[model samples]
Target chain A: MIPDDRKYTQEHEWVQVEGDAGVVGVTDHAASELGDIVYVDLPDVGAEFSAGDSVGSIESVKAVADLYIPVSGEIIEINEALDGDPALVNNSPMDDGWMFKVRLADPGELETLLDAAGYEDLLGK
Target chain B: MSDLKQTPLHQWHIDHGARMVEFAGFAMPVQYEGVLAEHATVRDAVGLFDITHMGEVFVEGPGAGAWLSGLITNSIIKGEPGKVTYTAMCNEQGGTLDDMLIYRLTEERWLVVMNASNHDKIVDWMQRHLPAEGVTMDDASDRTGLIAVQGPDSQDLVGRLEALAPHVAPIAELGFYTHIAVDGPGGEWIVSRTGYTGEHGYEIYLPAGAMLAAWEELLARGEDLGVRPIGLAARDTLRFEACYCLYGHELSEDWTPLEAGIGWAVKLKKKAGFIGRDALAAQKEAGIPRTLIGLEVEGGPIAREGCPVLAGDREVGHVTSGTFAPTLQKKLALALVEKDFAEADLMVEVRGKRLATRHRALPFLAARVKGDPRAERALS
Candidate 1:
């Protein structure tokens, strides 16, 4: 069930481009593999980060995973709703569970990410 | 992966969409529906577990009781038939080798169930110390299978089994740490009122070939009762919330039973000179060096295993086991720290950040294992 309107990373994160910004979140596969999400740690809204930098982390009942920035940009906003219920990431990883929004630093960097088919192939689906 | 062993229910787990992982050299199910769900199932409802990976050994003969009493920290001679005693085998220096359950089947027969990870080590240790004539040790791990159904509804689930019908009355009234063995056509079924989880439960030990039928029967009968197959991940969390000592985590060769908060199982005045009696007795008189303490972390980040425990800036000890306890809905950890600093203000360094923590009592949740099942039913 890889979403078509987004680009994905090998680390199981997906970013959807909206105008000059990109909304990022972990894919459904990653969320399912992590079991029940118990906690989420996100960077500040105004934080700046380069591509491939660890912006935050997601903690499940059994394990922890680092959230990586797929494209270098400034974090414009984070999903404040996650602070109340982290299970949203498990229940709706593609929509309401979206973690943060980034102001795209370079529009060309989006092309370097894998498309829906490529991500599906990476997951061996 | 090909070299890894598989239990009789391996195919059953796969057929049920369980996620498999290699643990203790066995290809075992790590999860089925999920850890949190399976864990909640065991706490609220009933959940089945294929624990066939654990080791079982039979020690029989005239000297079985006395021989075993001198080998373990707990006195086996004090326990009567149909009783189970949880004890630890230790080295000469009083370090824990492994924690196990000793089931006394008769005056001359006893069964020892140990962790699968320590199967070979414990078997070898027992063999090395075998007395000349009276004690005979038979390693029946490969031929044995274990199934556990744990939760508040476990008794009602297990009592419905046809195989246990003849013993059902006694089984229903079975107290904690007691068992009843039956000689059936399939073999000897040793059903014990015991479990690693804090919930009320029973563990059934039977022949390996009989496991599949028993597993299927439990699922079929428990369908309307909300019974689910649990996995090892939930097993760990359930035991953690119960403050049970996992072999590699809370109980290790570096820590003694007293340090692991299971000193009640260790007896130094039992007359029989167990392996670590002298050292353990001296340690008891001198005072335990470290004590296991529970902690509640303030923030989101979980203080996982191996995280350092700090008193102010000085490093005190490390976390033996830590996780987000599902039932308690709080971040908790069991750390073995210096006894003097156990009650002091503590901070656990998790992923390079120091998280504020407070000393909490053990067994984050109250255990329901000792409660009367019939009384609970009447109240409900």
Candidate 2:
């Protein structure tokens, strides 16, 4: 359920470029693969991190997945809605599941991620 | 995975859009309409399960009843012909070798159905222990297929099957933990009022090769009655809610029935010199180091197996089986904990975070079966 406008990470996180920084969330592929999302521990606001670093955790009915930071930056805001109904991540992975806002720590790292076409090839979609 | 086994109804399951997964070395179906939904169907309406993965063994001879009585923890000879019994065969250490159903087809014949993973183990154990020359323990699992139709409407759905109509008239009349040979689409079969879902259901055993034909006939006819093909995922959750023990989780070589809260299965009054008799009796008197307990988490994220169970500030146990009870809408966890922490309202640590967990009485979601005389039967 990933949109063509979004950038992709091999780790299954998706990023949609919103003006300057990016809106980040786990891919629908990830959520469906995890089955049911029961809990999502979000990263704290103003939390700075580097690319490929661990950001948070996404738990499902049977398993738990480590959410990775695709772009090195600070988490500007967390998805507070997920605290109440984590299922939102499963219902709207690209939209409501948008986990946090990252104030781009290194915009240059964005180039290292796959574009919509490249990512599609990786998934063989 | 080359040698992985498949149930007789494997192709039928695939045709119905089942997602298959490898479980206990068998390529088994794990879901059809999603675990939660299928689980609910079984709890509310009726759900059909391809339980061919369960191993079926038949033992016969004049010495059958007496020989089996010495092997299992429950009374095998007490059940009349065409009746069933739930019992556990334990190791010398009082650990469960297999929890199985003993079906008495006749005075001299019996059928033992066990977990697919423990089929070889149980057979080997029988071969090693029950060494009577006249008795025969035949592995009928490969030649037999089991189908469980469970829930409230199961009786109505299964009773109408043309092949079963003659012998299974008024299916609800058959007491729980009882069975009789009946005609099926493919051949004559055995139908028992046995289910793991804690519901009023029936378990039908038929010739293995004809399971596809039988499953198709049942599915096609039961569709209008809300019968759906369920899978292992739903099976696990349903049983967990009912507090049924999975072999690997609630039982293992290192765990004993006394410690697992199933000490009631151990027979201390018998002089049959059964395996694990002494060890279980001693444990029953002196008590065990650890005990199995049930926990209900207040919030989200079902506590799963291997998650550390923290009692206050200490890691006192590990969860054995945990899942979201779709019927109760609660996260449940069954833990094997130190006897010291087996009290009510024991807290649990899920993924490094502590949650207020209630250690309530198990069978987290109890089902109410309509009045059946089988209620008086000690099938527990």
Q: After superposing candidate 2 on the true structure, give the runs of residues whose Cα lies further than 4 Å from its correct spot.
A: B185-187, B370-380
Could you give candidate 1's per-residue lDDT for residues B1-380 as a string of tens digits? 67999999988999999999999999999999989999999988999999999999999999889988988998888678999999999999999999999999999999999999999999999999999999899999998999999988898889888898777789998999999999754799999999988889999999999889988999999998899999999999999988899999999888789899999999888886899889988998999999999999977699999999999999999999999898888889999999889889999998899999988877776667787532332100
TM-score of chain B of 2: 0.93
- Candidate 1, position B212, lDDT: 93
Highest TM-score against the true fold, candidate:
1
Give candidate 1 regions above 4 Å deviation.
Answer: B373-380
Which candidate leads the pack in DockQ? 1
Interface RMSD of 2: 2.3
DockQ each candidate and list the results: 0.89, 0.47
- Show the colliding residue pairs in model 2: none
Q: Candidate 1: global Cα-lDDT?
A: 0.91
